[model samples]
Target: MSPVLPPALRGLPVAPVISHPVGQQTTVQPTTACELPQQSATGWLKEDSIASGVLIVLVLTGVQRLIGFVRSLLFCRWLEPDQLGQWDVAWGFLMLAAPLTVLSLPGTFGRYLEHYRAAGQLRVFLCRTAVVCLGLALVASGILLVMPEAFSWLIFGSGAQQQLIGPLAGTLLAVIAYNYLISLLTSLRTMRLVAVLETVNSAGFALAGGLLIYCWQRSAASAIVAYGSASLLCVVAATGWMQAIWQQAPQICPAIPQREFWAKLLPFAGWIMLVNLLTNLFMIADRYLVAQFAPGDSEARLALVGQYHSARVLPLLLASLASMLAAMILPHLSRDWEAGSRQQVSRRMNLGLKLLGLSLTAASAVLLLVAPLLFGLAFAGKYQQGLDILPWTLLSGVWFGAAALAQMYLWCAERAAKACLATALGLAVSVVLNLLLLPRMGLQGVVLAAA
Candidate 1:
C-alpha cells in the first residue's frame, strides 16, 4: 500500500522508485545547468571568450620579447663578438637547465588540478604536487652542487670561468623553486599575474644589464649578475602570488590517500619530463654542434654560437604566438576534455592551426625581407649573412611551434606517453639529420636538420 502524503507533498509528482542491478532501490536526479565560476583571463584578450587569456599572454610575451630584442641589440653593439659569445653560454645555461628545474610538471600539474578539484581533493592535490616537485628539485640541486666547477668549464668553457660555478649553483636551486610555484599559479588560472611576472623579469633584466654594463665598464660578469638578479626577482614575485592564491583557495577535502595520489601523478610527470628534456636538447643541440664544427679557437667557435643564436631569435619570435595560445588554452582544454566537450575541443584546435598558418606565413615573408636589411644596419660586417641562416632557422621555430600545439593537445587528452613518443621520434630524426648534414652543410645543415 502507498504511504499517505502530506498536504504540501500531495501536489508534487512522486519520484518512482527504481530497482538497481544489485537489487537495491535507486532514484534519478533531476538536471540543473552548471554555472562556471568567474576567473581572470589574460588582460588584453579578455573579450576573446575562450581564447582571451592566451591571446593576452601572447601579446605580453611579444612585448617582453621586444624588450629582449632591445637588450640583445644593445649588448651586441656594446661588446665584441667573443664577449657576446661567452655571455651567451652563461645566460643560456640557466634556460638550458629548465627541464631539470621544471620536470614538465606545469603541464601535468594543470591536468591533475582540474581532476582533483572536481573530485573535491583540491588541498590534497596542491600538497602532493608541491611535495613531489620539491623533492625532485632537491635531488637535481644536489646533482648540480657536486662539482660546480666541472659544470662551469663544460658550459662556459675553461677552468678560469669557475667564478660562474657558485652563482649558477644558486640560480639552479632558486629557479627550480620558481618553476614549481609558477606552475601552481598557472594551474590556478592566474595568467595575468604570470604575464606580469614574466614582463618584470624581461624589463628588469634589460634595465639592470644596461646599468651594469655601463657602470662597470662593460664586462661579461656584469651581464651574468644582471640575469641572476632578474631571475631571483621573478622567483620572489611568483612566490608571493602563489601564496596569496593558495591561501584563499577553497579546500573541498582535507585529505587524500598518499599512495593513490602519487600513483596517478608520477607516471604523467615522468613521461612529460622526458618530452620536455629531449625537446630542450633538440633546441640547443645546434648551438653546441655549431660551436664544435665552426673553425677557430674556443672564442671563435663561441662567436659562431652567438651569431647563430642572434640570427635565430627574430624568426623564432614569430612562433611565440603558438606558445602563447598553447599555454592559454591548456587549462581550458583540460577541463573541456574532462567534461566531454569533444566538439568544442575540435573546433578550437582547428581554428588555432589556421590562425598559426596565416599569421606565420605573412610574418615569415616580412622577416625574410626585413631581417637582412635590419641586421646589416644594426650590426655591420658578417651579420648581414645572419638572414641567410635566418630563413631556415625560422622554419624550425614555426615547425616547433606547431608541434608544441599538437603536444599540448596530446597532454590535455591524457596521452602523455604518446606525446613523449612523438617528441622522441622527432628528436631522433633531428639528431640523425644534424649529424649527416652539419659535416657537409656547416651551420646551414644544422638548422636544416632542425627545420
Candidate 2:
C-alpha cells in the first residue's frame, strides 16, 4: 500500500541484543559507573533525620546550659571571692586533665562510631572505646590518688588557699568516668540521655551545693564534695545507659581486627587530644596567669583571680550555645565535605560565623547592662569590682568560640594537625601577652591577654 522506502530511512535500528551463557556471568560489580549515596541531591543537612537530630541536640544543650547557669549563680551566692577563685582554678585544672584522662576519645569516637554503626560494627567500636577510656581513667586516677598534694601543687602552685586535694582527686576520677560514658552515649545518638546526664549533674550540683551551704561549711571542699557526689551518681546512670546502647547495637557482621581498628583511631585521636588540651589551656590560662603574676600579696592576688572568674561565667554561659551547635555540626560538616560539597561547607561556615557574631554581641550587651546589678545582688558586692572585665571577657569568648568552630571544620576535614598548630600559636600569644600585660594591669591585663 506504501511506496518502498530505503533501508536506512525505514526505521531507526535497535542495537543487537547481547546475551551470556549461564557460566559467563560477570563476577564484579562496576562501582565506577554508580552514583555515590551522598551525591545526587542527597546530603548531610539535606536529610530530615539529620536536621532533626541537630535541632534536638541544640535544644537539649540549651536547656542544660540554663541549668548550669543557675547552678553557677547559686554557687556565687554562697561562696566568697577567695574561695570561688580557688575553686575556679581547681576546676580549670580538671578541665585540662579530664580530656587527657580519656585520651580525647569523645570527639574522635563520634566520627568513627557513626561509620562503624552504619557498617554494623557498633558493638565492637563501643567495646573498644570503653576499654581504652576505662584503662586510662584507672591509671590517671591511681596516680592522682597516690599523690593528690603533688597534683594540687602542679595546678595551683604553693601557698594555695584551699588545698582540698582529696576531694579534687576523687572528683577528677568521677568526672573522667562520667565524661567518657556521656561521650559514648552521644556517639550512640542518644542525645536526650546526654542532655539528661547534664541536667542531673546540674540539678544535683544545685541541691548538694545548696545543702552544704545551708547545713555544712560553705567552703571549696564542700562544693567539690557536692559536685563529686553528683558526678558519682551520674557516672552510675551513664554506665547503665552505655550498657543499654551496647545491647541495641547490631552485631550481625564481624568488625575489623582490634589492632587495625585502633590503628585508625589513635592517629586521628592523638592529634585531636593535643588540640583539645591546648584549647582548654588557653581558655583558663588567663586566670591561672593572673593568679601567678598579679602584683600583690597571695590573698589579694587570689581574690583578683576569683573576681576574674566571676566575670568569666557570663561569657562561658553564652559559649555553651555555640559549643552545642559545633558539636552537632561536626558530623554533618564531615559528611558534607567528604561528599565533595565544598559549597555546603562554605554555607555552614558563613551561617555559623554569623550566628556567633549575633549571639556574642547580644549576650555582651545584655551582660553589660545587668552585670553590676546581678553580681552585687548574687555575689555579695564582691564581684561588682570586675564589671569592667566582664564585657571584654565575654568578647574574647566570642573569639574563642569562633576559633573553635573553625577548628571543627579542620577536624572534620582531617586537618587536626593544622588545628593543633593554630591553637598552639594562640597559646603562645596568650603566654606572651599574659607575661607582658599581667604585671602592668593586674586582672585587667589577664582579660587583655585572653582577648
Candidate 3:
C-alpha cells in the first residue's frame, strides 16, 4: 500500500526507485537544492575535452602567430640590422626576466590549482600567490630602475642602451601580471579565454608597436612601450572578468591550513623556477654570446645577431607551439595523476611525445623548402646570412620543441627537479659549445651549438 503523504508533500511529484536483484548496486542521481550549488561549482572547474581544448588553442595560436609574423616582417623591413638586433636582445631579456622576477610562481597553477579547488581553497591560493608575485615584480622593477646601466650592460652587452632599462623595468611588471592571468585561466581549462587574451595581446602589439616603430620613434624603446601598454590593458580586462566570476562562485568549503598549503606548493614551484631560469638562459645564450664575443665591432656583431634572429623567427614558432601544447596537456595529466590513473598518464604522454615529434619534423621540412622564397620575398634578401643557416635553425627548433613536450611528463610526476637538472646540464653544455664555436665559426657555429 502507498504511504499517505503529508499535506506539504502531496503537491510535489515523486521520483520512482526501481528495486534490483541481490548484490546489485543502485546509483542515485542527486536532484536536491543543496546539490545544485556543488554541481555548478564542479561544472565551473571541470576539464574541457582535450580535443576541443587543443583545437581552440591551435586556431587562436595560429592567428596570433600570423599577426606576430607580419609584425616581425615589418620590423625587419623598417629597422636596420643593428637596430633589429637591439630589439631582439631587449625582447629576449624581457622574456627571460619576467619569469625569473616572479620566481615562476605562476607555473605552479597547472599542477596544483585543481587540487586546491577540490579542497575549496582556490581563492586563497590565487590571492596569496598573486600578492607574492606582485611584490617580487615590484622589487625587481625597482632594482632595474635604480641600476639601469648595469642591466643595460647585462642585456645589450654594453651600457650604451641604458635608456631601454627604464622601459624594460616597467614592461616586466606588466608581463608578470599578464603571465599570472594567462596561467590561472589556462589551469582552469579555460582555453578559449586564454586564446582570446593572447590574440588581443598579439593584435595590440602589432598595431601599436608597428605604428610606433614606423611613424614615431622607430626604436626598440617604442616597441617596449607598446608591449607594456597592451599587456597592462589585458590584465585589467581579465581581472575585472575574474572578479565578477568569483563574486558569483559558491565559497562554502573550509580553507586549508597555511602550513599545509605552502608545504605542497613551494617545493614544486622552486624546482619550476630553477628550470625556467635554465630554460630561458639556454634559449638566449647564443644571442648573448654573439653580442658579447663575436669577432666584430658592436655594429657588425649586432648585424650578425639580427641575421640570426631572422633565421630563428619561424623555428621559434615551433617552440612556442610546443609550449602551448605542454601547458594545455599538464592540467589534464595532473588531474589523471591525482585520480591515480598513473599508467594512463604515462600512455597519454608517450602518445603526445610521438605525435609532437612527427609534427615538428614535418613542419621543419616544409619550412626548409620555403626558406629561400620567404627570404627573397619577405626579407628582401637582406638577411642572406640568416637564410644560409635556416636548416640548422630549423633543426634546433624541432629538437627544442620535442624537449619541451618531453618535460611535461617530468612536470606531471612532480619530478620537476630532475627536469631542472637536465635543463641545467643542457644549458651548461650550451654555454661551453657557444664559447668554443662562436669564436671559430661565427654565427654558423652558434647556430650549430644551439642545435
Candidate 4:
C-alpha cells in the first residue's frame, strides 16, 4: 500500500529509487532539472578550481618576475662583479639552508592540511608544525652565529667574508618564516593572496635592496639587510591575515591520536625533505664548483659567479614558474587522490605536463631569439661570458622545470622517496659532470654540465 502524501507534497513529483545488489551503494538520480546540482557563477573562485588557481598564479607570478628582472638588472648595474657574485652565493645559501633547516615540514601542508581540516584537526596540526619549524630555524641561526667563519668558507669559498655570515644568518631566519607562511597560504588554497604577497615581496626587495645597494653600502651585506627587512614585513602582514581567517573558522578538537598523526606525517615529510635538499643541491652545485674549483682567486671566482648569475636570471624565472605551478597543482591532485579518483589525477597531471612543456619550449625559443638584444642593450655588454652561455642555461632551466612538474605525480602518490632517489642520481651525475668539464672548459663547461 502506498502511504498518503501531504497536500503540499502531492503537487511535486517524486524521485524514483532503484534497488541494487546487497552491499552495493545506491544513488538516486535526479528527476527534474531543478533537482540537479548547479554551479554558481562564482564557482571559478572556489578553492577546488585548479584552472582558476593556475591562472591566478601565472598572472601574478609573471608580474613578480618582471619586477625581479628589473631589480636584477639594477643590481648588476650598481654593483661590481665581485659584489654581485657575493650576493648570488648568499642568495643561494639562503634558499638551500631555509628548507634544510625546516626539514621541509611545510612541504607536507598541501597534501595533508586539507585532510586534517576535514577531520577538524587543522589547528593542532599547524601548531605542532609551526613549533617544530621555529625551533629548527633558531637552531640553524644559532649555529651560523657561532661558526660564522666555517659557514663563510663553505658558502663563499673563502673565510674572509665572515662579516657577511651574520647578516646571512639573520636573513635566513626571515626567509624561513616567510616561506612557511607562503606554503601555508598556498595549502589553504588562497592562490590570489599568495600571489599578492609574492608580488609585494619582490617589489619590496627591489625598492629596499636597490636603495641599499645604490645609495647606502654598495655591497652584498646591505642587500642582505634589505632582503631580511622586506621578508619580515611580509611575514607580519601574512600572519595578521592568517590569524583573522583562522578565527573565523570553526575550532574543533582533533580526534586523531597524536601518535597516529606523527606516524603518517613524519615519513612523508622526511622524504620531501630529502627531495628538497637534493633538488637545491642539484640546482646550485654548478655555482659551488665554479666558486671552489675554477682555478682562480676568490675575487675572480666571484666575478665568474656574477657572470653566471646574469645568464641564469631569465632561465631561473621559468624554474620559478614551474615551482609555482607544481605547488598550486599538488593540492588539487591530493584531493582527487583522496576521493579515489586516481585515473582523474593522472589525466590532469599529464595534461598539465603537456601544456607546461609546450608553453615552456615556446617561451625558451623566444628568449633565445631576444638573447642578443638583451645582452647588448640591457646588460651593456658587461657580461659577455654569460651571454655566450645563455643557450645552455636556458636549456637546463627548461629541463629542470619540466622535471619539477613531473615530480608532482610522485608527490601526490606519496612516493616522494622515489623522487628523492631520482634527484639524488641526477645530482650525482651533475657533480661528476662538473668535475669532469669545469677544469677544461671554464664557465661554459659548468653551464653545459647543468644543462
Could you say which candidate leads in TM-score?
3
Over 4 Å off in model 4, which ranges? 1-51, 249-258, 318-369, 401-418
CA-lDDT, candidates in order: 0.63, 0.67, 0.75, 0.75
In model 1, which runs have C-alpha deviations exceeding 4 angstroms? 1-52, 90-92, 101-107, 114-146, 156-160, 217-220, 238-243, 249-258, 292-294, 325-359, 380-385, 401-418
* Global CA lDDT computed for model 1: 0.63
Encode model 2's per-residue lDDT on 1-451: one tens digit a residue.
0001001101100000011222353343223322222122122212235566666657766766787787788778888877777778777777777777776766565556666755556666777877877788778878877776676666665435435777877888777777666665555555556666767887888889889865898777788888788889988866654554555556455547878998877765665565566667767777788666677765676678778878878887767656656665777786787688989998998898788778778878888898878887877777765676887888777876786566567656555456557767878898899899888877778787778
**How many steric clashes between backbone atoms does each model show?**
0, 0, 0, 0
C-alpha TM-score for every candidate: 0.73, 0.78, 0.79, 0.79
Write the residue-wise lDDT of candidate 3 on 1-451 in tens digits.
0111111101110101111222353443322322114324233334566688788878987899889988888877777678788888887787778867776677777666666665455567777898888899999999999999888778887778889899899988888888888877777787677778989999999898989988898787888898998899899888766774465344554556889878877766665565556666777788988988899787788888899999988887887777777766877887888788999998998899889889999999999889889888888778999999988998887787777777767666656457657877888888899899898998889988888
**Deviation of model 2 at 178, angstroms:** 1.0
* The 10-residue segment with the lowest total lDDT in model 1: 1-10
Clashing pairs in 4: none
Error of 1 at 276 (Å): 1.1
Cα lDDT, model 4, residue 73: 84
Error of 4 at 266 (Å): 1.4
TM-score of 3: 0.79
Clashing pairs in 1: none
lDDT, model 4: 0.75
